[model samples]
Target: MPPHARSRIESDLPGDQAAGKPAPQQPAWPDPGLLDEVQRELLNRPALVPAEESAHLADLMAAVARREAVALQGGDCAELFEDAAPSPVHRKLEQLYDLSATLREQLGMPVVTMGRMAGQYAKPRSSDWEHTPGGEVLAVYRGDAVNAAEADAAARVPDARRLLAAHDCAAATLKVIRESWQGRADGNRVFAAHELLLLPYELPQVRADPEPYASSLHFGWIGDRTREPDGAHVALAASVRNPVGVKVGPSTTAADLVRLARILNPERRPGRLTFIARMGADRIDPLLPPLVEAVSATGIPVAWISDPMHGNTTKTGRGRKTRSVQAILDELTAFVRILRAHGAWPGGLHLEMTPEPVTECVARSADARTAALNQYRSPCDPRLNAEQAADVVDAFVALLRAA
Candidate 1:
C-alpha cells in the first residue's frame, strides 16, 4: 500500500479512551476493487507510481525531515524555490513541488503545499469620480493601511491610492514598449494588452468604477477555500456590478450559485465563469463524478483546485504545529492528478505568504508562541518579503513554462 494511503487509514482509526492510545490493529488496506472505485471518481487519477519517481519522492521527504538544503526567509511560500534548479518531475507537479523542495532545503523542514488559485481581493468602491494626482493617491493609500486593523483591512478602500500608485508606476515602466509596438497594427493589441495585464492586482479599485474602464478591464476574486465568511464576497458584490468571471468549488450546487450570481448581475448575464472542485486524498470515492457534472451544468468553465496539504490535515482537532510532513506530500499529489484530468493547468498560484518569515501563523515559531494566535491578537502579517516573493514568482513562471 502507498505510504499516503497507510497514513490515511491511521488517521481515521479510532483512538483508545482509557489508555489514550490509538487502536492497536492496522486497518485493512483498501482492496483492488476499492482502489478502482476511488480512482474512478477523480477526473484523472495518476497511474500507479513509477518506481523512479516514487523512490525520489521518498528521498525528498527524508531529506526534508533531516533538514538538508531548505532555507526559510520571510515572504510568499513559492519564493522558497526561486533559486533552486527544479527536476523534470518538479515541473509536472507545478509550483507545489518546487515550493516543497525549497522549504525542505531552506527551513530544514517540510512545508505544506496547496494548489494554485488565480484571482485577487476585490478593491473597495471609490467615492470620488475624477482621477487624483499622485501625491493625493499616496496619502490615501498610506492612510488606508495605517487605519486597517485586520489582515485584509487595507482591502476595504474602494479607491485604494496604494494600488493606484503601483498600477501607475508599472504602467509607466511598460509605456515605452507599449508605444513602440503601437504602429504594428495586428500586434499592437498585444502590446496594449500587455500594458493592461501588468497590473492584474489592481481590481478592487477598478471595480469601483467599471464603466470608465469597462472596455479594458477584467476581474476575479480569491479567498481561502476553508476560510468561511470571506470579506471578498461583500467587496465583490459592491464592485462587480456586472457578470465577470467567478471561480468557486465543485461541490457547490448549481441552483444556489446561479441564484447568487443573478442577484449580483441583475441587468446582464455573467460570462466566462470558472468553478474549482476540491478533491483531496481522503474523500470517499462515490461523490466525484456527480460533483463535476453538477458544476459543469451551470455553463461555466470548471477547474479543480485540489487541496493536497489542507485536505487531509483538517481533522477534528488538529493544529498547524502537529501536521505531518508525509501528509502534505500525499495531498499535493492528489491535487496534481485532479487538475491534469480537469483540463486547466495550474495557471497561477496563491499562498498565505508574508514579508517576515517568523510570524504568528506558525505556532512553533517564536513570534506566535510569545504573542498568541487569537483572532484579535494574530501575530505580524504573513506576507512574503522581496526575496521570498521573487522566489514564488520564479517558481510559478517555471511551472508555467514547463506546462
Candidate 2:
C-alpha cells in the first residue's frame, strides 16, 4: 500500500514491554552479549516488515471470525538456513501467492495468506536430544536459530552466536517477501509467522515498518507443546498487540480454551486472538463441538482456523514422517461443518505446504514409502507440495460452499 496506509497501521501496534505470561523454562545461553547484540541489531535493522501489514492482518482475521473471509496460512515445514537464499524464498513466495489465488477464485472471498517462515526458525521437538540408530547421542536439532539441522555432535549443540545468524537469516527472508509483495496493489496481504517459542531468539525477533521486535512477528502463535495456561508462551503472547494465535490439539479442554481466550484477548479485540484447532479427522468430529460451544458461551470470539497438518502426521514403513492428503482434507471438512453447526465461522485453514513436489500424503499413499516420496527433504515435518495443496484447495472450496 501507500506510505500513509503503512504509517496508519504501524501506529496501531503496541510498543515493546512485558507481553509475556510469566517465566517458563528460560534456557541459559552460554553468552548473554550475543543475545544483547542480536536484540540491538534487530532494532537497528529495517522492521522485518511494516506494522501496517500486521494491522491489516488483524482486520483480515476479524473478517474470518465473522465468516466473511477465510485465511490460508502455509509455508515450509521447517525453514532451512540455506533456503534463506533468494531463490528458494522466491519459489516459496510463488507457492504462497498461487495458493492464495486458488482460494480466492473458488472460496469467493478474501483470503489471508500468512507464511510460516521468516521468523519461524525455531521448533519444538519431542526431545531436546536425539541419537542415531547406532546410539551416538546429540543435543538434538532445535532449529537453525539455535543449532544446525545436522546430526553431528558439533552441529547439534546450541551456539549462542546462532541467535544473530537467525536474525540475519530472518532479515534476508523478510527482504525477499517484502520485495516480492512491494508496491503490489492486491489487498490480499501475506503475513510472516512462526511458533512463538520461548527461546532467546524468538523474544527479540520482530519486524515493523519501523519498530523494535520484542513480539513483532506479524502473526505469532503458541504451539500445542507450549499452550499451557500457566506457561510463558501464553503470558508473553498476552502482552503483544500483534495478531496472536494459539493451536489447540485434540487433548485441549474447553475450560482451558475459554481461560486462554480471556487471557490472550481480554479486550475481545477482533482478530486479536485466533484459535487454531488441530484435532485429527476422527477427533475433530467429536472433540471440536464442545470446545466451540464453550468458547462461544464465554463470548470471547477468536478466529477459528483449522491446522490439519500436525494432528494428521503419520510414520511410514521406513520411519519417515508423513501425512495423508485425505486425512488433512477430512479433518478440515469436519472443522467447517462442526463450526457451522455451532453457528460460528470456520475462519480459515492452517497448512504445512511447499511448492516442491514432496510426498506428504496423496492418493495411492497406502503404499507410500520414504523411497517413494520424491524430493522428500524436510528435516522436521512433512508438508503438502503444490499439487497436493491444489488438491486441498479444490476439495476445501467445494466443501465450504456445500456448507
Candidate 3:
C-alpha cells in the first residue's frame, strides 16, 4: 500500500464499521471451459505468422545471413538475388523467424505458434458499463481529434455516412492494435490491456455514437486460468519529456490530460475514478504533483508504473558487464520506493517490448557484459530484439513479484 491509498480505500467504506460483517469470500476460480473457449476464438481469428512454425528455426539465421551477404556483395550473385524477389517460401519463413524472436526471448524458450485474440468492439448508448463474468471488460475509445472532426462533418451530410463509417472502422482497428495482447500460456504469461494508453484520444461524440464512424469503443473479455471473466480496471499514464526551455502547448499540460480523462471516463463520478500513474524519467518530478491532483480531483486511485528498464535516468556504460550495472539497479529500486512513498504504487507495470532476439534497434555488444543502450526515435518505438524484449518482460514480472 502506498501513501494515501490506504486512506482512500478506508474513506470509501460505509461509516457503520461496528455493524459490518466479514468480507465475502473471493469468487471460485473459473473452469477450463472458459479457457478452451478463449483458445478456440483466438485460433479461429485470422492471424499473422511472425515466426517460423518448423522446429528448424535455426535455418532462418542462415537465410538471413545469405540475404545480407547478397546485399553486401555487389556482383552478379548479388544482382541475381536482388533482381529475383525472395521466394514465397523464403519470405514466409523470414517473417516467421522475425516475429518469433521476441516471443522466444521473453518466454525464455521457443514458441511453436502464436495467435491474435478476438476483441468485441461496441458502443454503449448510456454511460452504463457492461459486466463480463470475470469482472469488467476493458473498453477503449478511438477519439483522435482529426477523426472526430471528420465524423462531425459526415454527420451533417447523409451521403457522407459511409465515409464516416470507414473512418470509424479504421479507428476501431487502431484501437485493437493498441490494446490487444498476444498470450503465451506455458511460462509466466503476459496479459496486457491496451485501452489505457488510448484514453487521451477518446472523444465525447465518438463515445456516444450509435454507429460511430470515426470515434468508437472496443473491448475484449479476458479470462484467467480458471476460465472466468476478469474484471475491468483502468490505468491513466503518459510519456513525459523535459519542457523547461521549450514552449508548452495547451495539450501538453497536466490540466489538459485531466480534462481528457474526465471526458473519457464519464461513468466515473468525480470522487470515484481510479487511475495509475506511469511517469517517464524526463518529466517525472514536475509531472508528479499535477498527476496526483488531477486524478485525486476525481477521487480516483493513482499508482505509478516504475519502469526502470526504460524510465531510469542511468545510461549504460561502454560494456554490459560494467561496474555501473549494480549501481543502476540500486537507483531503480530507490526510485520505485520513492514512487511508493508518494501513493503511486499499484503493483502493476507497463513495458514496451517485442518477440524477437535480433539487433533490430541497436547492435548487440561484442562482449556479453557490455551494456547496449537504445536510442528510441519515438514513443511508439519497436526497438527491442527478441532477447532484450524477453529480458524486459522477465524484469517486470520479477519486480511485481518482489513488490
The sequence of per-residue lDDT tens digits that candidate 1 reaches over residues 1-403 is 1121121111111111111222111112225344333323221222111223222322332232232322111122221211112331133233334454554454333342322111111112122121233322211111221113122423323232323333333233223323333453321111111111112122222311213121122223332231112222323332333223233443444454554344434443322222232344455133344444454454433223332222332311223222222333343344434444544333223333432333223322223324432332212223332244445445433433344
Off by over 4 Å in 3: 1-254, 269-279, 282-286, 301-335, 360-380
- For model 1 the TM-score comes to 0.34
Per residue, candidate 3 scores C-alpha lDDT tens digits across 122-224 of 1111111223335633221112211121223332121212223333433343333323233523222211122311111222112111222112212111111
* lDDT tens per residue, model 2, 1-403: 1011010111111343334334333333445556566656655655565667677778878888777888888988778888999999999888888888888888778888899988777777775566686788666666777778777876665666776777778888888888887776555657788888744555454443344333346788898878888766776677556888999998899989999999988998888889999988768888999999999999887899989889887777767778877788889899888988989988877888888877656553465554356668888888888898888877778888898
Whole-model Cα lDDT of every candidate shown, in order: 0.29, 0.75, 0.26
For each candidate in turn, the TM-score is: 0.34, 0.88, 0.33
RMSD in Å for candidate 2, one decimal? Answer: 7.2
> Whole-model lDDT for model 3 versus the true structure?
0.26
Sort all candidates by TM-score, best to worst: 2, 1, 3
RMSD of each: 22.3, 7.2, 20.8
For model 2, state the Cα shift of residue 122 in Å.
0.9
